[model samples]
Target: MTTYNLARYPERLAVVQLGPGSEVPSWAESSSVFSITATSTETSIICASRSVPAKTRHHRPYTAFAVVPDEGSADFDIASGVTGVLVALLTPLADAGVSVFALSTFGTDWILVHESDADRAEEAWRRSGHTVAPATPA
Candidate 1:
């Protein structure tokens, strides 16, 4: 597996599940990094936990990490694509029994896990020869 640096984002996040075709909520705009995915079954939003409304159907307290790209290069999206990148990265965490929530942008890969497992996840990445950096708050 190719070793990559993982940078932690300092925010407790929530994954909200809304009915299909739901519009992206205004609250999500405040997040430094958030994603909205709509599928036939549901529309899911991953945003800062503090932004979610009280009645929202959501899961919370997730800590996030982003794959650090090589300096002067965005080649993080190699021929194999982000899926391949995530597969390589997720293996270590999975082996350690850490549940993860994953997302991707046009060229970046993200990894999220319950904050309770943050330390374990970092250790797993470190054991696999990846550098897990300290959280950088936005």
Candidate 2:
């Protein structure tokens, strides 16, 4: 597999869950990197650069890494038919002993690591021959 370029989002992110019938929260829209997934049973929102308010009734917060390629438009596409792409991208982190939580949409994937592991994770990706840069504005 070819080496992939990556950008690290400056914001700290959280993954939150709300009831299926609940309205989208106002904060979600303002997030730098936001993704919403809804199903009959529940809704999951990934909010970057901000944390869901403690008062908001939701699942526990999970810190995110919010990585993507450096050269594409915000909605960069990853070929679904490609094999081992994710494995190649994540192997470095695994070798560095950093665990991750991953979320993927049609166009790209976002890998979430604990807030405490962010620095090490970034370093690991860099060491693995991947270029890691600061994320560009949306």
Candidate 3:
């Protein structure tokens, strides 16, 4: 198993579900670290919890983990690019019964779990032989 370096993001996030073809809300830009995914069925947004309006149909307070990889003399998990990284990452979480909301972008793959499960998420990854650490601001 390729070990992944996951950086835990500071801001708690939200996953907002909107109808298909819905315009990306400007509020989605509330955070630099967010993912907007549009599919045939719906437009799902993963953004800073504070950015989403209280009335939106959304799930909040998820803790985000970025597969930052490539620690240089460190490790490699960069890009939305990783072969089987998700399987490696998710399997343990699944075994641990942690529900995850995953997002992949040009930059990287994100794994979000309810804030209540943050510690368990970290433990799951660590126990799976991966490294989990606080994200360093870019």
Q: Highest lDDT: give the candidate number.
A: 1
User: Candidate 3 — which residues are off by over 4 angstroms?
Assistant: 71-82
lDDT at 42 for candidate 2?
Answer: 90
Candidate 1 vs candidate 3: the lDDT winner is 1
> By TM-score, is 1 or 3 better?
1
Model 3, 38: alpha-carbon shift in Å?
1.5
**CA lDDT, every prediction?**
0.85, 0.69, 0.83
TM-score of each: 0.87, 0.75, 0.85
**Local lDDT at 60 for model 1:** 89
Q: Report the C-alpha displacement of residue 15, candidate 3, in angstroms.
A: 0.3
Cα miss at 54, model 2 (Å)?
0.9
Compared with the true structure, what per-residue lDDT tens digits does model 1 show for residues 1-138? 678888988889999999999998888744656888899999999888987888989998899999888777555656644345777789999999999998877667889999999999999999999998865665
What's the CA error at residue 132 for candidate 1, in Å?
Answer: 1.1
Question: Weakest 10 consecutive residues, lDDT, candidate 2?
Answer: 58-67
Off by over 4 Å in 1: 78-83, 135-138
